[model samples]
Target: MRSNCLPFRADSAAATAEFVRPQRYALRASHSIARCSGLIAAVMLAGCMSAPPSIDAPTTRASTAAIDLPLADPSAGVDMSLPAQRPESLPSNSALARDFMELSFSLESGRAIPQFSRFEGPITVSLGAGAPASAPRELARLVSRLRGEAGVPISVGASAQNHIQIDFVPRKQMSREVPNAACFVVPNVSGWDDYRAARRTARGDWTQVKQRVSATVFIPAEATPQEVRDCLHEETSQALGPLNDLYRLPNSVWNDDNFHTVLTRYDMIQLRATYAAELHSGMSAPEVQAKLPAVFARLNPAGGAVRGLRDDPTPRAYVSAVNRAIGPGNTGARRAAAMSAINLAAAQGWNDTRAAFGWFALGRLSVQNDPETALNAFAKAGNIYRATPGAGIQSAHVDMQLAAFALSAGRAQDAIALVNRAMTPALSGENAALMATLYFIRAEAYDTLGNPAQAQQARVDSAQWARYGFGSDAAVRARAAEVAALARAGRG
Candidate 1:
């Protein structure tokens, strides 16, 4: 989920308290909230599950850099041990059993969500086929005792039959146009034969064998897609493995296993800043924003208390200090700040609004001679806005950046599409100015596309918008010159 600002509501001053910064709004690295800087590169969002920024075409490089660093040793492999015990224990009290007894698993078809189950529980007892006759009673009693210790009312439930159902639902960050591949079953993993059969019986047709489920998570503003997936895989597996290690967990619940396995593969992924640090042995300003989505995906931290991991406050403090240092500087401090925000998102629990703010802020740092970074940041912002709800204004701003970024990236078709999306007749004042910029971008995109006729028309449209939008002689004259150039080119 792209975290961006919610509309300021008259009814919820208290609710919006956490986001009350000195500035009414702050642009992080995202287009949804920042001014377009033509030269800055994009960075990833700093949240869990976010995609990395995609880079424009890389500039041609010589065969070797002036100096190269030594390579690190290969990573040691993970211990793929299967646990002997199940994560969820059975309830002990028969009385408590009824409370959780109704628990069952269901899978969504044609979506990444392999399955999810909710049951009433101080403890819920789900018996495997091998469960002994006394399993339910023992489970209920065990749960009641646990609840009593915690000073909570005891409720428990159990099911004796080994029944499992698979369901599929939408994945997060799913494109509105096309549905990504979903897992009804994965390539290898077991025990849900009955579940698959049941579906065929119910639907009266054979379906795909399996679906591999991915955690539909929001990416931070400064990571990449690969990085986001890796981070999510690690956190999810680490969080859930005590009860269900992928190695030993029954095939009935294999979606969760596959999900975790996928994430483990991404644990080493890094954002541009971090990648640069690793590669250069020093921090450097990111050269582009398009590299963020993948990195952010891998390192986004889950907020709240995780069940088993030891807490580390160092990363938390480091990111915070970095943000403070960047609040005013125009140099390395700003770069550090942007990197810190991404790290913070990975350490802290940031919602869409916070993520959007961070991304917008990051974008601002790229405004100078780094328009590539700015364009990338703007694209990231637009993507965030698309994920965030109740952020029309922010989304509109993001569209403006997307248009500009596309132009800068040499993606003329995309630029025109972004311009079209950003233009809304109802917008006024500052928004109108943005719309005019969209026209300028579209004209630029069309020119790049070698569509001289459309480019000329778009230039005329841009000139009209420039007069209305900027109200500056320089703007009019610059656009007029562009229009004249288009005319001359057509004459030739």
Candidate 2:
């Protein structure tokens, strides 16, 4: 996530401290690959059978700114027809059917996910070592919401019998807790479904017999508060069941491209349907189909009129561009794609939020090669972000980005100003790692200005924030120690 060099003392104290850049990884699924068409048919067939069926399975592969410009309406170019009061009311029978099928099947190679099946028993979740301090409370809130809204029997507690393990860890340490494949292998990923192993029954149905369902979710230590929340919601929900991701689903987090970070009402409906008494883990498509009408009637009774809707292609395109830009290898092509997306979004007059994201991606891609261009892009992003409602946290992120760029450009005073502005109190889960980096930059700025005392204090502050934000991982602690030693030498 962070890539830069830091100044350090040449003394023995400094020699003991090692500085490591914070790097982010992507999430990848391990297993066989299956064609999407076959997967869909398999899902349908699975639900159709009344008797227990045996089957062989195949695998398938899968911004900031505050400006005075006219604020583009957040709802503009967006489908706001989905009722806020009742998310369940928005999905038509067709939508529900499609969503249920997708959720019931695992996308990580067409394997059948052994779901909680029934909410009759307790589902305990425990936080692992180095988890964020806020993890327990935030998880509790999510569990409570799910229990109340989806009738899921889940609670937050540790037991040998615990079915879930949630961990908030530094990126470098992710491989130790989750499978290496589950490690953030993709670029621009904040979290991952690190470990999810389940055993199925002899009937090819996922049953309680010899059943073992354990999941581990990895959250990068550098993630901001909002990212933390989204990760908690999405990863935890996926761990429950519905391990597949469908890009076609516009209203569900199940679609990575949709950008619906939090669990939507539609997501809740799907979960409720999965855990519904009549639906079992091993049901074939026809079997599941037989129970669908009743399920929809009970969930949405009066809202069965199907309205075929699709997510806007602009955002999806923009997301693909950003992903390409940050993707591993192929740096030149990635940057070119990012630039092209930014230009396209600008030319097309995409919605403020979407366009702003494109600009932000461009800024990130161009920061090293073209600081001025990066600054301009970030500033435009900030302007658009300020205009969009409910984007205060995002605005903070932009400020941080600007600060990082300024620091790199040797504009110490400007960097300090931006860092100070970005640090204003806001959300609780703001990325501590980013905050620590900001403080580190501020310290460097003070050092450049020959303000030794202030620089030392800023360095101390940076170390403190890094410890709190990144946990006590060996690398993190080493970095903190290096900062302290650097500050001490600067005073000398």
Candidate 3:
């Protein structure tokens, strides 16, 4: 109930901007933006196209002569450098932020256990009625230390009868927990009658003990598993001890089922990708289908439905589902549920947005198997976000997602047009940063369309936009290699 512990509204959050704290903290951290390798890689990674689509005819542009402008050299003003900026230090609430970031990431990447392999939960102390006034301060230090040591935060809340309740904030929707009664027992806490009653009932019940804590993690529903994962890890590390412990943690504390459930959908998506790759290489679709079910079975129970297979028993199911619903198609519930698992994985301090996005891409692929439907789905997702304020989604980002979908569906014109429309100042910031991203999307679309000169121009525009977004020449210059690769491919 603290004033500073504000509720986050998804619709109001800016996607392309970072929130910089006013006072700098002396902390060190490392992160890498994953690069997409191909269809499989893209599915597992964030900001990737949904699926493959055939390239279509060019739509008529307004006019070439009217749009004439000098194209700058891609090399002249590029920034290809990685700057080492000092991390901001925290004074009071620093522990919470740092641990939340780390545990979140580890969860998303399927490496949660390894990341939090050495955390020792705090020795919780309970106070009776009229205990010293130092309880709250001591509790705060414990919370901070746990956050600093585990690189994850502990959520503090009012016990049922006014007693203070403390527990780790889960990184994902699903996570494993140890038996609370025996593992970390606290005695009678003072001034909270309701809490005492609840604790009396929870003394031997692990499930009930967990229920005492609220699900207070800050991850949004729309957050990709990877983002949630990274945030948890960063935050967890920030909360742990002054010294670090990277190995030799607890075994009785581990929960494999919890881990497996969260990653099930992603594993299925990867299996599908592997199957598709095998077919693309030389194997037949039927052969891939025959072998793929085994992978699916591994994810599901002994006699249940396959965890991540999207296509119906036959391709007809997908086609019929799409034909029946022109508006938004079916909800990818299973895929979404799987993505939710990242919250738990994140508790251990891993970041893996790629895997989360990949799962979503698979769900999208199932509902919209073709270009038109996929485009509509992206548009619908945007609309869904716009209509709901705290839905934890950004409508603007839908533009980028639509472009990726168009590229995969071979609808170059659609992709290009969407980017162009979204590039308007009224619609977005349209500054160098946004313009740079738009240009990149446009270039990808143009390259897909077999327009070399236009693609080259788009690349140059992209570099300019990058300059505006990053404010660093080194960063923009590094994009040259990608531009050159696209040019070479387009030429071929």
Candidate 4:
């Protein structure tokens, strides 16, 4: 649920000023399935308006008189050659401070936004309908991670007074769950575009007493395992607090650049700082700033500095190219645009990571029509990513794509092999959707090979992995039917 902050297109200061309230904020993150080019257009058009001339402007006679009067230069007291004055020192490292400010405040709406209201006691979280089968385990794992890193009493279990509910639903269900509220002014924040809405119950004078959070996260039924994991890490973390997205943050899931998909050490520090006992639910920026130093000191007594602030060097052209290719509109034109941009990027020698994404996009677009070419493209991407540190996860994603293509080509045995290769323990633990889909595919493969016993077992495994509320039985049956039909047609 990340979005880029595009400039508001207003004809007058008054119009822009009037936009302060009721402004929606979106996270700018990778939307692997949903297309957002039209969202960009909508934001531009919706914010633009014609404005009349100001009533306080001088009349013609007054302007003439003012022109006739002698006036001093506007820059008279300022020395243009001298260096500008440096502002007050930040509370943390320079990059962290800058990113913290951006994440803590809505520059467009002039709001001193705070994190989600905190609980005084242990936090109990529950999973709702549409949650993945692996939700319970993964959420328990995340709860442990948060408890260890932020020293919060957060746990996942069923309770009468659960503080938070996380729902992992399909894209269609998500659209209904996450209404396009007027508060969401920005568009195309994330693919699947999940959202979190929190309510704070407070006593007199805005003193918060209780908090409840309802978060809806979308996992595309067909999304790859890695994409599912990224969505889980980000949407779930954001639900706890730190709702804002800052592109400037180099190594955090809170950044929209999609550079670092998982939560980083820096992110943990921020969470620790936010949930520090000294800070309250409704503290002002200055108050929080006054306390951050002590919080950081206590958390990092060894002076472990915040790291990974270097911005992604991926060119905009490459990003746009990949987006257009994957987007769901104007297929011919968008693919052409993507190819053109990829060519230009290659000519100029772009980063390997960006190139890998570009090739991945091309592979995605080619899978249905040209399986061989798509496999080659995915293999190239996998090879390129394999050389990078902590990028085995990305390479596994490529393998998942390859497996999907293999399944589409009716090569059930090959698809099963690829799926097995991609289903690493880390990935399986993090993504219930991926585990469900893997089992579903395995079921289909077994059915194709006339192994009904194994196929039924696989179906049970799929449902188990998908949990109870995510339409596991129906989705698995539908996918199996589709694959069977494809195999019968011999279209691959």
Candidate 5:
């Protein structure tokens, strides 16, 4: 078990200020089956709420404010912006290959498939009748990305014989049925009804199928556009490619960190490898593994055979502890669990990102009960992340938390410093939510410093990103009010 892989939601493994309930990873099992599905949940933190993620976790926050700010002019509508295109950095091929094998051959629960499977021909996708109004537009965008990025031959809105059926159901009904799962994908199922009947049986199991012909992905119809997009990216990738989610993957959306919400460059590379002409459906896991190096060599020749970041396997005890700490429970029990997770990390003598997560968990849970402890935990987590390669974005999440605290304590300079340091990673990572939150923090900091011009500018900058990150004008305003409230708290 990897501590970084928080299933569904809960825990600030991703960088969210508040610890929320972890979204349950949906599963299909039997004594003999090929594999389970991707058990990770695609969780959103609305606009400014960026989470360390680890999963769909809504974990701990030290201080939560809900004060309403002054009303803005209604003439200025909510703003939204698409992230700019950036160059893709390749991790070591060794890491990619490892990620590829684990993600391809197993589920998030570590269930294995004896053989590799994929569609032999072009894939067609269709929207269910119940899909949200935004389904067509989002689907088209996703399709375009798939074609341009992944080189996967996929088209949306196919009228006849669709290979992938995406259904948008009421979030309430879906949530009730799959309590822990925000959304899910299953094999040999084309509709919600089909999935309901076969959910627990081999009929819906990925391992049961030797060749992929059809699958269904259930999403929340009424969810915000961002939420729908996140869900689509996670489940659609699984429906067409890997059925597994790995906690160790630092870049790809295949990890449960839920820090990443879109199909990333790394994700595309894997998909490209999966659909390579040399490889076909029904190949064994070993066979696929053997072919990946050559496949990666052709796909990413720049990625030399260098050793990637040293990764450690997360222990079951630590994972359970972190989960219990972040998941729903009494305060005392939750705090104890968070401490256990921290202790387990220390005992393991690990120095990877996973250990940092334990500290992050502790800091998050301590915010309300023990500010000193929370501060210490965040600092420790930040220090460890700074030393860890590829953890800049992860560390930014912690910085956001600290910045909020700083603002609440009236330490405007400290808050600005934290936000400034984190801005680069937040931008590079294309995390609109984190970016907006950082801007909000900056705005408050500038205001506190008597720099009204800078404060106004910061607010202006936060607008477009906030719309995309938070979904609606109301949500963006809510986040803005919350930031202002932080300052008010310090003054009070």
Candidate 6:
């Protein structure tokens, strides 16, 4: 989710948790508002790097000096990780076209974007005051991807006019102004003060901008390195490309139904198309829509294969229901909201990821209060995820939830099997938190089965990645204790 001037991002397997941010939004690292021992908090919006301001970017290297950085570099010690890139299943041009229109024409608020917007020349990025040690390394890596994958002419910070400034404001201050925003990007603002004054006025609105002159992305200064990095991927992507996030999108960070923490292949294609020569700033919605067929035909020729499902538009009621279910509210209300979202998805005849997400949300919200209902919801979500393409990670998330219940019920073998099924996809997704939780669960299951050696190994692996996922030695230990307690409470 992004917030400075937009709505907060929602999550899936990772819509993965909480729904939109209030006012301008912040993208949470995971979707689940609450992650206990087993729930893998599904958010962690799409993911980073540094390069010169150029249309041409590297094939592998993210920064020119990335490899040359001294051993003393601070990021050398940061335990952050990125998943390996996997090939994408292409959406037909027809599907791509509809997504493009929706993404370009309106915001999550349903407010219209009067015209298209993009920087007309090379864009430079700079880290502003109070940015943490982790930012530069992450920014460089992202810049590399933007240039190489998205084909955007972006570079490291410069004093020049074409620029995007990223400021890491303390979370408290951000929460006051942005409210619920985890982080966000805004057009025409250069710093926090600029955001403060312009935020309530038209100056900060994305829809008002025709050609993006300069923008600023506001992030939480005190957030963990991983959290900060997650914000960078989401807010920065919006600063460069589309402003709206669609729930119907199965892939791409552009959709809040789910997330890709690091920009997915789908996101790269969209960005590449955004910067393609055929389009430009100030084009009308219809104009951009008209040109996208040729754009997709050339840029994503694979999508030309066949027509796609091209699902119907998601209703405002459904979106609102999911948001309430995942967001702050009383337990009864949250449950009611979850139920409403489920009914709405069914009524819409959604047999897709969107529906699976609603079920996932119900399972998550019910885990604490309605055990039987939670299990059944998880089962339903798991079934749909299994049948869906590119939803292995989502299935893994459902497995994570079910393994917890199984462990609590003394089903050690069941817990172990579910953990095993989820582990690979968790690793492939580079979701350290989910991976950490899974390892912890595995360790507990091994111990229940009287496998001390395996349990010890799992604990060791859990600690290793927990540092990356949970951040800091103390945080890792705390998370371990939480999971350890869950196991202790289980009937082994």
- Best candidate, lDDT-wise? 6
Per residue, candidate 2 scores C-alpha lDDT tens digits across 1-492 of 111100110000111112111110001100111112222122111110111122223231100000111222211111113223322235477667656765664443345544333223567777767665556666777898788877777888855553666666664555354322222111111234312222132422333222334555666664433345556777778666565665335355554332345576677877787677777655665677678777777877775643432223334465466556544446468668768777777777764565666666666555445544555676777777666644444455666665444443344565567666655411222344545555665666677677877766765555434443333333343333333232222232
TM-score of each: 0.32, 0.49, 0.28, 0.50, 0.79, 0.83
Candidate 1 vs 6: which has more TM-score: 6
| Residue 278 error, candidate 2, Å | 14
| All candidates in order of lDDT, best leading | 6, 5, 2, 4, 1, 3
Candidate lDDT scores, in order, read 0.32, 0.48, 0.31, 0.45, 0.65, 0.66
Clashes of 3: 85
Question: How far off is residue 284 in model 1, in Å?
Answer: 50
Q: Is candidate 1 or candidate 6 better by lDDT?
A: 6
- Every model: Cα RMSD to truth: 24.1, 17.6, 23.1, 23.1, 10.7, 11.0
Candidates ranked by TM-score: 6, 5, 4, 2, 1, 3
With candidate 2 superimposed using the best TM-score fit, by how many Å does residue 324's alpha carbon deviate from the native?
1.9
Question: Lowest-lDDT window of 10 residues in candidate 6?
Answer: 45-54
Cα lDDT of model 3 by residue, 169-239, tens digit: 23232112221111122222232333335454644322222112221122222222222222232222222
Q: What TM-score should be assigned to candidate 1?
A: 0.32
TM-score of 4: 0.50
lDDT tens digits, residues 422-442, model 5? 777676665666777788878
lDDT of 3 at 269: 30
Cα error of candidate 4 at position 378, Å: 2.3
Candidate 2, superposed: residue stretches over 4 Å from native: 1-122, 126-152, 157-233, 241-319, 343-348, 408-413, 424-427, 446-457, 471-492
